[model samples]
Target: MIVSLIAAVSADGKIAQSAEQSSLDWTSREDTRFFISKTKEIGTVVMGRKTFGTIGKPLKDRRTIVMSSRTGIEGVEWTSEPPADLVARLEREGVTRMALCGGAAIYDAFLSVGLVDELFLTVEPVLFGDGVPLFRNGARINLKLLETTKLGDSSVLLHYLLLK
Candidate 1:
């Protein structure tokens, strides 16, 4: 299965101004529409518990998997499984692709494990100055540019393929 990381970030590389801050507050409507379209096409999304908390509910029309120690979420699947194991299981279950929707640590976890195949980043026009970054662990991962498109007058979407 193919795994991709998707996020809307500030020009300064921050994903959110605070833990509670939602992307809807800063991202353009074009970016939001693109994100929804892409994830729905992928059919499944996995994210960290904090990321899930920020969203407050399962995404409509997609399988929501929260990577957390806690269990029994009413509308989502909760798992503390490692990245590789989770990916393997999903592939076994016939999932063709999945998106890694994150709050930094989750992105780092899958990227560090070398599971991510692509990245879709929407860069907005604002600067957070200091906030949650796109990747918390700061690991070096190479990527080949695939495509770039203007999301709106003030934002750009960057697509890249992971270089293994």
Candidate 2:
């Protein structure tokens, strides 16, 4: 599967102003529209529990998978499975593409496991000097730039492929 990590980050590399802050609160309308379109095109999205909590519900028309220890979510699938195992299972089930929509730890988990094939980051104009970062656990992956798109006058979408 083509696994990509998608996020809208601030100038200072922060994904949110707070743990509960939604990207919709800070990202541009263009970025939001791009995110929705890209994820829907991918057909599946995986995110950590806290990220899901911020959104407060399942995203329409996509398979929502929350990586949580607890299960039985009404509209989404909940799993505690490791990133690679989950990706492998999804590939076996014939999923061709997936998006890793994150709140830090989820990004770290997938990237650290070397399962992410690409990154789609929308860089917003603002900066949060102190806030939740894009990668909580830190990652050391090199990327080759694939594309750069102007989401708006102040927002840019950076697309990159992971270098193996």
Candidate 3:
């Protein structure tokens, strides 16, 4: 399976000011458009419970999977399985592509298990001073830059291949 992680962070590498705040409020419009377009293309998005809560609902034309200990979430698939198991199951089901739509812990879990193959990041121009870091407990892994593109006037999109 081709697993990709997509996120927009502040200049200081924060996803949001707090758990209550949405990154969409501060991220650039170009990043938003890019994210939406990519999600539409990929079709399956996996995110943590808190991240799913912030979004409020499942995205259109996509399968939403919530990686959480708790269950019974409506309109989405809820699983407590680790990232590797989840990826294996998806592969068995013939899902060739998936996206790690994150808050933080999800990113760490996937990266820790060496499931992330690609990373797409949008670096916005603003600074949050203190906020949620992109990868809270992720391991130090190397990456090779695949491409970089300017988004709008300030933000820049960076695509990298995770070095195994």
Candidate 4:
């Protein structure tokens, strides 16, 4: 299966300034619109449990899958840490491609396992002094350029093919 990572970060690579999910408000309108557009390209999306917790709900008009060890979450399919089984289930469901919209840990997990196919990043203008890094514990991985587009006044989206 082909997988991709999509996210927006500050100039210095911070996903958010604080633990408050609402703190992502610093992200630009153009970036958000681009992200929404990208989502329409795929029918299913895969995200970490923490990301779903931050967002509060599944995105409409798409089948959302959440990776988590526990259950009882509404509007989401719970998954376990060893994603091998979860990935098999997804394949059985005929999911050809998936995107990773994250909170860092998920990125690390997928990257470490060599599952990511592409990386889509929106670089914003401003930078917070300190905050959550995009790939907190992810090991170094190489990528080949796929596409790049500029957005608004000070934002750009860079797409790269993940090198396994």
TM accuracy, model 2: 0.96
How are the candidates ranked when ordered by lDDT, highest leading? 1, 2, 3, 4
TM-score of each: 0.96, 0.96, 0.96, 0.90
Write one digit per residue (lDDT tens) for candidate 2, span 50-87.
Answer: 98988878999999999999975699999999998998
lDDT of candidates 1 onward, in order: 0.91, 0.91, 0.90, 0.79
Task: Give lDDT for model 4.
Answer: 0.79
lDDT (tens digit, per residue) of candidate 4 on 1-164: 77778988888988777655653578789988887778768767888777787787888877788887787467867777465666677889888877788767787787777778898899999888788887766478888998889999889999999776
**Of 2 and 4, which scores higher on TM-score?**
2
Please write out the lDDT profile of model 3 over residues 85-148, one tens digit for every residue: 9999999999999999897889888988889999999999998898998886645889999999
Between 1 and 3, whose lDDT is larger?
1
lDDT of 4 at 91: 87
Q: Tell me the tens digit of each residue's lDDT in model 1 across 34-122.
A: 98999999999999998888788999999999999887569999999999999999999999999999978899899888899999999
Candidate 3 regions exceeding 4 Å error are: none
Show where candidate 4 strays beyond 4 Å.
Answer: none
